[model samples]
Target: MKVLHIIPSVAKVRGGPSKAVIEMVKALRSQNVDAEIVTTNDNGKDLLDVPLDILTDRLEEYGNVPIRFFSRFSPNLNAVREFAYSGALTAWLWQHITDYDIIHVHAIFSYASTIAMAIARIKNVPYINRPLGQLCEWSLQQSKLRKQIYLNIIERSNLLHSQSLHFTAEQEREEFHQLGLNIPNFVLPHGVHIPEPIPDAQDKLRQILQIPHQIPIILFMSRIHPKKGLEYLIPALSKFQDSNFAFVIAGNGESDYMNQIQDLLEKHRISDRTHLVGFVNGETKNLYLQGADLFVLTSHSENFGIAVIESLAAGTPVLITNGVAISPMVKEQDLGYVAQLDSEAIASTIQEFFEHPQVAKQKGDRAQQYIAEHYSWAKIAHSLINIYAKYAKYTKL
Candidate 1:
């Protein structure tokens, strides 16, 4: 089967959606499915020197999957940040929409998604819409006016017309149902790539960051966005000022948001205890995960916390709030601690882990085993192929 994936960008800095697309495509190809991607060059404000190296409009190989990148008409638009507005990309989709058996568009309210879905409909091609946590209650509340306008203007129709709405978790599917949209839903959790253990990872991380060997590290490794509930985490962690723990926040965000985080650190008087290591990727990212005593993600609403799984894969126990869709799994499997969204609850959980170091280590070991057994990309890809086959056969009928 031939599948075409349309996304805004695959730049590493774009976070989970980009990573999801790349990993999913690679996995699909390994299952003997012909998978390809078409995206725009949307590097956002904080561009990470990613090698685009585009020589033509034709497809180029990014790893094993083929991909095409189009240049945006207006690169900068304060009103619509991180959006890819490319006439060339839309034209290409129009010309080739019928070539694929399935069109999987990741993320909603973007030019890529809207145009791809519109063209796919005209060509009578079945398309699946992956909102990537956009439909959650917390997400809907942000930029309410703009989202409402977009919903009425384009997104509502784009959503209704799709063959299926893909959700990474049941929590996300339920949230989408709350929107009153009558659409077929498919729930498939995103997979993770479990890395081999690095023997010197902890030592390397400590040396690079200038952190002492004895200090316990609580790591937060995601985009520094308000939705991450860092405002709550900072204050909760402030209660640990007297503790021998170091809070390392290893991601970048808007300048204003970064300033807000810095302000929170100062206000809590934990500036000396907290370290902002900026955006980390590649080996540095793995080292941080391997080196950390514990990993924490206090997102207000996450469809699937990829970092949570990554932490587990790194053999580090996680501490996450109920807002994370995977929190139930963490709690049920004893992979980590699950707390209420309250700062007090989060703070108390951290204290529990600190008090019981041996329990934390056991949990971390369990987490690694669970992730390896259950969250393989190959298994996830096979399941997705079955779903596509079912839908594709129905479309033919």
Candidate 2:
């Protein structure tokens, strides 16, 4: 089946949604599906260094998945840049959307996704909308009135007309249901990419970072934003200051917010124990994952914690908050620890992890098996194909 996945931006800075679609399309292609991606040349403050307005392969430097990068027409202004406006992309989709049997639009409230849905409707095409956690409560609270109006005027109508709403987690789907929109929806989480083994990666990474040997590493990897709840993390790490555990913060964000994190770390006097490493990828990222003792994400609202699964895939346990949608699975499967969104709960749970290091190791080992068996992209791609087949049959009827 010919499928097209449209995302606002596939830049690494965009986090999981970007990575998710790329890995997903790769898996879909491996299954012999004609799946490809289309996105803008939006790389946050800068544009992607790629040939624009045409299909290009190996832009992501991973596999042979075809991705068409269009020039982002957004001005220097951060507000407009975030919109990811692309006239070329819009024109291309307007004329070529019907070329594919199905369309998967990722993210809403953006120029590309919104226009893709509108054009798909106009062209009488079947499309699925993945809000990418935008519809969740904490996300909606960002621009309360503006989003409420946008939903009523533009998004809700588009959703109602679409074939389905694609949600990554049960919690995300449940939150959408509360909107009372009569749209067909399904839950499918993002899959993990199991990395190849790197010899003594843990020790190598520790030496590179100058962290002492045998010290446990608590990793907080994701886009550093207010939503990530770094305030709680500072104090949580502070609770174990005398214990000599290393806290690593991977990922980057706005300078203003990043400075705030620095201040928070200093305020709690855990600055010495914490290492704020800017965006990590490739071998460096894998090393951090492989070496981490606990992967902690104290997000206020997470659609699905991709890093959690990746850490698990690397035989590292996770400690997540209830705000993360997958916390239930993490707890139910006994993969790792789950705690409330406060400092006390997080600190106490972390203490539990350190007290019984053997138990954490056992959990990590179980998590590795669980991730490989269930969270692999190849397996998820098959289920997605089945979903598409079901819809295709309904369309014929």
Candidate 3:
């Protein structure tokens, strides 16, 4: 069966939804399924340069899957108006979409998903919806009024009539139920790309990032957003100041939010203790993980903390808030600590890691083993192919 996977953009920095779709396409093709990715990216660009470029690279190895990037026409107000009024964009999409037996659309709350759903319905083709993290309560709460309007006006039909809906975790499914929208749902966590053996580069990596070897480093490698709760992270680090543990905030986002974080660090007089490297990917990203003594994600809400798994794969212990979906896994594997999303809880948890060196090391080792065995993308892809097959049968497309 042929499959078409649609995403807003394949830009890795856009976060997990794009990466999840790329991984899905790669996995489907590996099983000899005819799969092609249709993204709203312009042509003549190198996909490998994108973060989560692994998908593009892996697809090349198979030489069977086709990835096509169509030029996006003013994806803002102009694009919306044209797609809604002219029908040119949607008509073009309908023609191309008919070539595939089924389409899987990722990220529900974007113009991309909306258009794809409309085209699928017009063309009478089977389509599956993967909400990514949109179903999470935190996501809806971020802009409930706007989303509720869209749901009532545009997305309700799409969500109800789709062949199936995919979710990454059970928490996401539970959150969807709380939203009072009942649709057929499937829970599939985004698979982690297990890296090659990480070399012993503690000293080299520290020098590269200009981090002092003497100071312990806590790594936070997500986009700089308020939902990520860095507002609490910076001040909390100052509360129980560890003379040795420094903070490194990587990843990028809205410039104003980033400046606000920098301002907080400076205000706390611990600016020297914090490093803002601004979005590192590939080997540079892995190096930071290797150099870190501990990994921490203090987000107020997280669907499935991708960086948390990355820390585990890098053999670094992670300390996360209970709000993260994978907290149970971290606790079950004895990988790291999980605490509440408060300053005291974050500070106390970090303090315990430094206080118990032996136990901490053991936990870190378990973290590595747990990720390698369970979170591998190869295994994840296999599971996803099964899901696709089930939906294809039901749709009979």
Candidate 4:
């Protein structure tokens, strides 16, 4: 089967959706499915270097998967932040819509996804729409009037016409039902690449960050955005200001929001204990995972916390809020604590881990085992292929 994925950008800084697309395509190819991506050259900023070559309206190969990048035009409007308007990409999709058996549009309220769905519909090609947590209540409430207008004008139709709506977790699938779209839903969790015999150099993160060996590290690795619930996380960490643990905040965000985070740390007098390590990836990310005693994500709403699974794969216990879709699995597998989205609850959970170090270690071991057995890319690929076969006219899988 040939599958074409349309996304806004495949830039690493775009976070989970970009990473998920790359991994999914790679996995699909391994299962004998022909997978490719079409995206715009909007890497969030000119300074952010994406791995893809910036040749306009041309296809480039990232391993076995072909990626076509188009030059994007940005409208000077605050309301439409990060929306890449690419007429070239839209025209290209219209021209080649029927070349693939299936079109998978990732994320919503984007030019690529909306146009791809329209083209796919005109060509009578089946398409899968992954909202990537956009349909959740918390996300939809943001820029409310603007989104409602967009939804009525474009997104609602785009969603209703799709062959299937893909959700990364049961929570997302359930939340999507509230939209009353009457579309078929496919529920599958995001897959992570588990490192075998997990990297053992523990001191790399500490040495690089100038953190001491004895200090316990509580890692939070994701985009530094308001929806991540870092405002609550900062106050929670402040509760342990006198403790020996170091709270590390990684990933990049807008200057104003990041400043707000810094101000919160200072106000609570936890500045000395908290470290903002900026953005980290590759070996540095792995080291942060391995070197830490615990990882936490207090997101307001997450379809699937990829970092939570990454932490588990690294054998580090996690503490996540109920807002995170994967929190149920974390609780069921005994990987870590799942608490209410309250600063008191988060602080208390972290305290429990600190008080019982041996218990934390056991939970971390279970985390690693659970992720390896259930979240492997090969396993995820098979499930997705089955979903595609159910909807696509082509029988080959």
Candidate 5:
């Protein structure tokens, strides 16, 4: 199958969706499917420093999947920020969209997704849309008026005409259903790739934090955004003022907002205990995940918690909020703790975990086994192939 996955950009700064699409395509390729991705060099606050208008070896180290990067149109900052406007990408899709058997567009409210869906329909090529939680209730409320107008006039028709929709979680699909567009969608969560153990990961992390081995590392590895609920996490963690745990903040975001969060940590009198490691990837990221005593993400809205599952797959325990779609699974499978959105509730869970840290580590065995059996990209890619074949045939092109 010649499948083309369309997304604005695979920049890690865009958070989970961007990262997810890259792995998704890599998994499909491993199954011997001719899967490719077409995206812009949009890294937010900076364009990706890569060769444009062609597939590059930029991400070959991360995953060998082929990706064609188009130049992002940036005369108007608003257009780039809100829409990720790229006339170059739009024109390319218009010309080559039908070359693929099927198109899988990720996210709505973006130039890449909106234009691809429209062009796919015009060329009579079947397409699938992964809303990436844009149609969910909380997402709709942001820039409410602008999105409502866009949906009614453009995206809604594109969605109704698509062959099918793909949602990563049942909750994501159900929430999109509430929008009442009545499109066909299947729930298929993103798959996890297990990390190999780093022998000195524990010691490496402690050394980086400049702390002793006895000090427990409580990690928050994700994009530093308001949506991450750091407002709740910092205050909750501040309650641990005298505790021996070292809170490590990973990932990066806008400077102003990042400064504001740092201020919050200082105001709560926990800055001394906090270690800010701005953005991490590759082995550095793995070291932190593997070495952490506990991982946490208290997101106010998350379609799926890729980081949470990855932590478990890396043999670490996680503590997450019910706002994360995977919380129920984490709770049911005994993978980790699930706390209410309230700060007190989140703090309470952390306190309990610290009191019985061994119990949390014991759950690592179940967590690793569960992720291995259930969240393999190989299994997921086969299932998605069945869906694609139904609409695109074995080799539609």
Candidate 6:
């Protein structure tokens, strides 16, 4: 079966959705299905340079997968919209949709999703839409006025027309009902490819971050955005007078907002205790995870915390706010703490974990075992295949 996965970009820098699509497609191929990526990324190149050398290498790496780069001359700023509306792009996708057994749409509330919606409708093909957390009320409220207009017209129609919807967690599915939007759906968790242990990762990460070997490092590996609750975490870090622990903020986001977050750190007079490492990937990311005493996410609302599960895979306990949809996993696996969104609650959990180091490590071990058994990409891919096969066979193309 040929499965075409649609995402705005396959760029690793775009974070979770890109990573999720890559892992899912890779996993499907391993299971003897012919899977490919159909993205607006055009080799995932940066707008200014659009370096052919780098783009060539990227395409070469995934040579087996067919990539159709549409409208090389389109403006990069609104590439999503441009791609969705382009007659050439629409014609190309419409012509190809019938050749594939399933079209998997990732990240709704985007131009690509609208195009996927249109194509599925015209071709009579079965396409699955993965909201990837955009369906949550809080996420929608972020652009209240604009999204309200978009939803009333474009988004709502696209959603209703899709073959089936895919959710990252049951919480997200339930949240959709609260929004008064109902559609056929499946709940599947994002999966991780467990990385091999880093040699002396703890010491290596400490040295790289200029953190002392004695300080207990708490790691937050995610985009540094306002929705992530970094503003809450940064201030809460100041309240902890204990000198033995340090907070490492790794990841990047909008420049102006990131500067404001930095100013928050300086204003709290805890800048010395906090280190911001721009963005780390591959072994470096694992090193930061292994070096940490614990992992924490204080997001306002998360569809799924892939980072939380990844932290557990690295044998690091996670302390997440209730806003994360995967808090159930934390509870079931005995991972770490789950508190409300307040600064006091976050600080209190950090203190408690520090107070009982042995129990904390035991929880971390249990988390590793749980994620190993449940959240591998192999398991997630199989579930996705089942969801696709259900609609694909019944819909007859």
Flag clash pairs in model 4: none
lDDT of each: 0.85, 0.87, 0.73, 0.84, 0.88, 0.77
Query: How many clashing pairs does model 3 include?
Result: 0
Poorly placed runs, candidate 5 (over 4 Å): 393-397
Question: What tens digits encode model 1's per-residue C-alpha lDDT throughout 1-397?
Answer: 7888899888756777788888899899888887888887777763433334342323332454677777765546665555667888888888888888888999987888888988888888889989989999999898899888998898888889888899998888888888899998889998999987889877777777788887888999998888899988888998887788888999888888899899989999998878899988777789999999899999999999998999999899999998898988899999999998888999999999989988998999999999999999998998998888876624331
Per-residue lDDT of 243-350 in model 4, one digit per residue for the tens? 888889889887888889888989999888778888887777888898888898999999999999999999999999988998888888899989888999888888
RMSD of 3: 4.4
**Model 1 — which ten-residue stretch has the worst lDDT?**
53-62
Model 5 residue 302 lDDT score: 88
Model 5 score (lDDT): 0.88
Error of 3 at 186 (Å): 1.4
Output the worst ten-in-a-row residue range by lDDT, candidate 2: 388-397
Tell me which of candidates 3 and 4 scores higher on TM-score.
4
* Local accuracy of candidate 5 as per-residue lDDT tens digits, 332-365: 8898899998899999999998899899998876
Candidate 1: lDDT of 355? 96
The RMSD (Cα, Å) of candidate 2 is 1.8
Residue 70 lDDT (model 1): 78
For candidate 4, the C-alpha RMSD (Å) to the true structure equals 2.5
Residue 228 local lDDT, model 6? 92
Question: What ranges in model 2 sit over 4 Å off?
Answer: 60-63, 392-397
Return the TM-score for each candidate structure.
0.93, 0.96, 0.88, 0.94, 0.96, 0.90
Writing each residue's lDDT as its tens digit, candidate 6 over 1-397 gives 7787877666555667777777787788788777776665432224322232121325543433444444433555654433343455566677777887778888766666678777777778877888888889789888688778887888887788777888888888888988777678878899987778888877887888787786788888897778899888877778876547878888877688888988998998888778888888877888888789989999999998888889999888998998899997687668888989999989888889878988988988888888889999889888777777787734332
